[model samples]
Target chain A: MQLVTPGIGLLFWMTITFSIVLFLLSKFAWKPILNSIKEREDSINGALSAAEDARKAMDALKSDNQKLLNEARAERDRMLKEASEMKDQIIAKATKDAKEVGDKLITSAKDAIEKEKLNAINELKTQVAVLSVDMAEKILRKKMEDRTQQEAFVNDNLKSITLN
Target chain B: MFSNKYKITKYLIPAFLVVLYVTYAGLKLANAQHEVHTDSTAIVTGTETGATTHSEVSHEESATEHKPEKVDAGKLIMEHIGDSYDWHIVTIGHTHVSIPLPLIIKDDKGLHVFLSNKFHHGHEAYEGYELKEGKLINLSGADFLDLSITKNVFAMFVAVIVLLIIMLSIAGSYKSNALKAPKGIQAFVEPLIIFIRDEVAKPSIGKQYNRFMPFLLTIFFFIFINNIFGLIPLFPGGANVTGNIAVTMVLAAFTFVITMINGNKNYWSHIFMPPGVPGWLLPLMIPIEIIGVLNKPIVLTIRLFANITAGHIIILGFFSLIFIFAEMNTGLGFGVSAFSVAFTTFMSFLELLVAFLQAYVFTLLSAIYFGSAVEEHHHEEHH
Candidate 1:
């Protein structure tokens, strides 16, 4: 009979004691503990998402760096190509100008030499005519001192001219 | 991995083993009973003559003769499972060592409080009150309230203090190191709390689990600790706190109160109107539904009380076998003790599993009831 029976005293004690325990625990223990767990979970999630954002930023930065490096390399290649082409054009233009100047000088010098040769030929012809006249005059004056000889010379010159 | 056939065999083998064990125990108990009957008759005859010659014999002689009296297995087991006014630790030779608890009672004279040792372990009365079969009775036969903190109640206090220490410390750690990982007792207890939350509360009580978490956790750990403590045969642990119907009744009552308080209109509607039921069956259905509501907590109370008490009884039963055999024949007692101790040890280990399992079941069921109470209903058209 005692085994199955319930005592009021224990029940009263249990109600009061358990209620106190539940109240104290809920206030001091459970609320704080549950809050901290939630806090830790939120913080962990925050950290994970932050790390993800950082990784994404790093990826973006890396891609931007790669794009910048490619652009720089392309710019360098374009500048180098342009500079080389300009250098070849400059050298070719300078060589063509130098050849034209040398041709002009040689042609002008030839024209001047031709003109001097013609002049010298003309001068020698005139000097030859003058010298021939003087020699003829001296020969005539010496011959004419003897009348007969002079006449003979003139008659001979005329006969020779008629024969020619 | 158990294939279909193997699974069948698995269950079948255990069932067969249980049948075999029960049959064997029945035979042994029957034989032991026959022997006990003869032995009790002899004791009764001997005591009758001894009582007649009591005038010449000293009181000490009578006490010594009554000391090693016949061992009644049922009484022994019941005593082990039942509550007591004192915490009985052990008995050696003719001496008994136990811790007396405070006795508080209420009567016409008002509330009276004193040490239970005043009764001298049921030997004599004190201040008009005498201990009778573990209850304090007034000699005047007046109605009184036995509100004394008995063995079970004292054990509960011990359990409460232990729970406070463990939980407060864990709570303190959460406060001090809010961001750090759980360690020590926190680590050990956190998983169990999480299990009750995720496995028991969340799934059963759904989104409103937070409202019931404190109560659920309190009862879970409280019952679990008491159950484990009940298994230990030592001073701090021997009190059958959880096995007591009064404790389980209070626990089940709490669940009942919370359930009824939290029960929504839908819950009541389902009980009274009961959707899809024929109109003619209203009266029958309503009473049954009300009974159903009351039955849930009643079942909860009895289930926990019986399971724990039964486990204690089985183990004690095994222990009594040796004593029963020894009273029949000394050599036979020695031989039976080997088997008795083995079975008792095995049962104790099984009880360890049952302790945790019963706690889980109780919490789970309470959460389920809470879930049902607050569950939402949806109307659907059926063609």
Candidate 2:
């Protein structure tokens, strides 16, 4: 093994130089680096804030959608209730109109029947009267055929009137 | 004039040397434009043995000179440290150990290697290996400044440059498009950057994360490079710099200093006289807190050093089985060597993940300490 050793001068110079170099590096190079790091942290904070806002927006939207859904269900229920009421009213009115029409038809038919019966009775009476007159005429004609009858008939009639 | 002199003393030669080191190392093998195999770091151990011809036995009573009996290749191979397979593997008989390239430094004159007679195996009495070729023998009398053109030094240089290029590229991408989707190398780098910035820096230092980014990044990148460089197979970029205690110590020291400097009044007060506590308990708590502060960096240092060193030693130990089993018999050698290749390959893959992990851990610790230092306990203010 070679027992060659480094002299003291090299060590002395190296130690001295290394110390100074470190000092210069500390002074000149450290500040810029730290600034950049701080900038990055600020950017990360911005991203986190943006994410939180998005979550709130989504929650609000979900509640609004629920509210709209509830309102739509209420409106549908109201419309069905109104339509049911309208159907009942329409049925009641129609039933009243049908009953009125039936009553009017019955009344008009009764009146017509009564008129027809009266007319028929009048016609029958006239006929009966005509026939009775005719029959009496006939009877008188038969009696007047005897010559003596004409004088007697005139006498009877004069006496009866004087007595009355 | 004296203040100005103090400023000069603080910066002048030191800055110049850093620039010089970077340039000198970069010029060696910097794939700045297209950094492919330019690992962050690598560790290559050398098995340089004293020649069998003249391993002279001399008893020169100096730290530099002691001699041993002529060691044959078989014994030398068994003891050989650095890049060999044995250092990566530890078995029942042998433990993994790395022989560092004799540390070298360069100047106007040629290269040199330090002469140390300190027997690595023994603290007692022994001889040391000397260079065979006199002309090739580059020795500086100073213990540390052995300027030799060794494989490990060149690797260290190359690895550092490779790391710089990768980091610079990542920095550029960040500057150009911080917000856009990362593609190419940007994809690989951006996650690490953000993790460090958001998880490590911001939470730790509160309002002061911006002030500590560069220091954190440099340490992370430096550790990463050295760790990656240590894993490569070849010599030029294969020295485990992070595994070395000396290297880890310097990094930990930086963390300690930064924490101390940046700590506000609240931090110091909390450590010394914790709020709402009994007056009598202050004495016990204060010393413990001080020790605790010191211990943080020590842990950081040891963690990196131990992890990096262990990976290399494990790889070496597995590799040494080939030689050990080879001595057993031909059939055993072939069978053991075959299995070893498979095992080593599996481990090497794990090392890639580990390289990045170690870097991450070091950076994380530093950031945490910085965080505590600048932490303003709001309750204390209310009191």
Candidate 3:
């Protein structure tokens, strides 16, 4: 019967002792313990999100690098195409200038040859006229042996011609 | 079936070994019991004379008349489970070894404080106050306060010291290794602490769990350690602290006080004028709700006390069967002891499980009560 009954003294002691323990533990122990746990959890979460942000930044940087590389390749291709076009233009201009200079030289050479042929024909005509004049003079001198004979022959021929 | 001779020996060898083991254990137990009986008889006789001489003038003369005979199972079990003025450890051949605690009493005359040994195991009276059936009473039939440190109190002090050491060390680890993971005792206890916090405290106490966490944690560990200690049945153990109604009542009272102190307007309103109930039902519902508040703590008190006490009783009952059978026949007693010991061992293991379970139940229920007290009644917004 006494076992089931509650004693006031025991109750008093229990209340005092339990209250003291609760007060002591709550102040000294529980505060630090719970705070540390929460702190750890917060740090873990921060680290995780920071890592995620870093990964996204890396991805964006990779894409930016890829875009730059593609632009550089396009620029190189355009420069190569322009350089080849300039090379063709320079070669064509050189060829056309050389053809014009060659054609002028040929025309000048033809004109010189035509002028020399005309001069040569003119000299040959002069020389042939001189020779024919000389030959006529000689034949006439031989036929009139003496001046008197020549006069008489002239008179005689004239007279004959008149009489005839 | 092939070889019957070989099969017979195979089963027979293990059976022979088991029989040998049982016999050895039974002999040891019988020897110990014999020693206890002889020792207890001598002490009883010596104390009987001392008590008669000192308390000859007292009214209760038959208080010290108990004698050692064949075992009285009921008396023995009661003595084991009940609180005492001193901590009895063992008896060895007429010598009873016990630790005497201080007995403090407040009466009309004044406060009287002395060692409990002066009463000599409730055999002799010390300064007109004698123990009558485990109660310290005055010979003059006057009322007084007994604030003595009994066996349960002493056990509680030991338990408190152990709790302080374990918890403080764990707290230190948490401080030093703040970012690192828990280790050692911290590793062991952190999970249980988290369990109470997450499962018990958070779910029941909701958002304001932090306020009540300290109280809940204290009660949970205190009850749990004491329960585990009571199951040990050795020195520093077997003090039925949680089994005592007074101890459980105090624990329950703490919960009751906290709940009432922390009770919000919603809590009181719900008790006095319950929402959603008809106006006419107020008269009946109000008192019932009020009783419901008081009943929660009372139930908490009785639940812990009864569960622990009942477990101790069942274990002791199994132990008593051996003596009861021994008195009938020597061989019968020996035969019964085998079963008795087996059953008692099984019960003790079961009690271990029950100890933790009861502690959990008590903490969970207390958390639920605090939850209700601080629960906010949010009005539903009609769509």
Candidate 4:
């Protein structure tokens, strides 16, 4: 069992054997291993491609979202503008309508006041005329009550009439 | 241009071989002194105070006269030359350079240029001695040739060639879809190739990793294949190429060089004057950063060298237990040797994992180093 100084003969043969084995292994074993590596590479490329597509999609989605947001903002702005404009128009229309109605009421009121005043003046004149007539009658009756003055005034008036 | 690149790559294995030769020679030389490893006559009996000494003398020792080596390049190269080495020192000596043809055994040191007057009828042998310097010792340059081509080297070579053939062949298959239904080796190796490209190179080095892919792939395969090759006990596996420190050092050096060359202004700035650091602290930070630059490769070298070396040593040590116990007593030897084999085999099984794990760790670290060097450590680029 003493450890043999590994013989030169042993060394020579071992070299040959391993060389053949390595050569053979290189021929057969390495090819498949490389294929597997290439396969791994292909898979990696595929993964990278997928990742690229995903990133692009994400970017597209983000821009689209921004566009939509901008559109929403614009629509909101337009609506606000329209509401303000409509409010102004409505206010202007209401004010004009109120002025027109006020003018009609004032004209009607002025006519009514003038008609009442004319009626009042006519009625006063009638009353004054009637009172004057009544007063005259009363004065005549009073003069008649004074028979002598009344006869003389009557005779004077008849004489003045005969002469005309 | 291709050839230059190939030339660079050719050195990687040669570098491994060179280290193997050196380690083997060092082991042999240490064996004479009885103390490179743990299983030698110098070690004592028990696992006590002096028990470890006997274990140290188990390595092979060559007969020597202890001469200080002359520092000649030729001599340095000659020392570590492997069994296969046979340099013609003298051509016109009439009988193979005055030295006997096939003069000595692989392990025995023999002179390449034998002088007619020196030995038996125009034959002489090589000489060797330890090269020494002030506080340092190296073998003369002559002995530095591939002295011991261990099994690890063979296995590593085969692993490399095999890896090449497999890769080239599979690459053909991939390009052509050759196998209608490929199985076995193709299946295993192809994935790794792809993994190296997509996983290792791309993420760290970026999409421009194509140019760098081949190197990374080569390194991964080289380390992985050798590690596995080391595991096999019969032939190629025993070389322990990864275990050698010199080999790992060179590998780390390659990384360091590549990283430096590829590094941008950003990388260099971090080393010389780190960014975001206060002006007052720049003096301190700069030195530390400079030190860190050197530390990276050193850490890399030690991590690999130690891990691989540890595995080999442990396995060998386990096997040695049988001899140690048997040497102590006949009964103990019988029982312990049997136990040691089984234990060693189990350890070898575990070593396979370590082999791969270490290779992975080394590769990962190398990749990290590359990444750091190329990384843009400035804020201006962010905008």
Error of 1 at A148 (Å): 22
User: Candidate 1, what DockQ?
Assistant: 0.46
Ranking by lDDT: 1, 3, 2, 4
What are the DockQ scores of the candidates, in order? 0.46, 0.09, 0.45, 0.01
Interface root mean square deviation of every model, in Å? 1.1, 4.8, 1.0, 9.6
Docking class of 2: incorrect
Task: Between candidates 2 and 4, name the one with more favorable TM-score.
Answer: 2
Candidate 1 lDDT over residue span A8-119, tens digit each? 8778878877888888788878888888887888999999999999999999999999999999999999999999999999999999998899899899989998889888
- Per residue, candidate 3 scores C-alpha lDDT tens digits across B147-179 of 988888888888988988888888899999988
CAPRI-style quality class for the chain A–B interface of candidate 1: acceptable
lDDT of 4 at A8: 38
Q: In model 3, which runs have C-alpha deviations exceeding 4 angstroms?
A: A66-164, B1-68, B329-341, B381-383
Worst 10 residues of 2 chain A by lDDT: A1-10
lDDT of 2 by residue, B1-383 (tens): 89986885587557645644553343232222213342432221321121111111111121134223322434433232222211222223334243333434344453534422222323222122233321122234332233442333334456656655565555466567565456687577657777888888888777778778888877886788778888875544456556666567778888999899998998899898788778999999899989998999899978997788778777776777765544323334455665577577878989888999999989988999999999877884445
TM-score of each candidate structure, all chains considered together: 0.73, 0.57, 0.73, 0.47
Clashing pairs in 3: B39-B94
Cα error, candidate 1, residue B243 (Å): 1.2
lDDT of 2 by residue, A1-164 (tens): 22123223323433554565455434443343344445555667777888888988998898899889988989889989999989999998999998899889888988988888888888888888888888878887888778779668877887787964
lDDT of 4: 0.58
How do the residues A51-94 of candidate 4 rate in per-residue lDDT, one tens digit apiece? 99999999999999999999999999999999999999999999
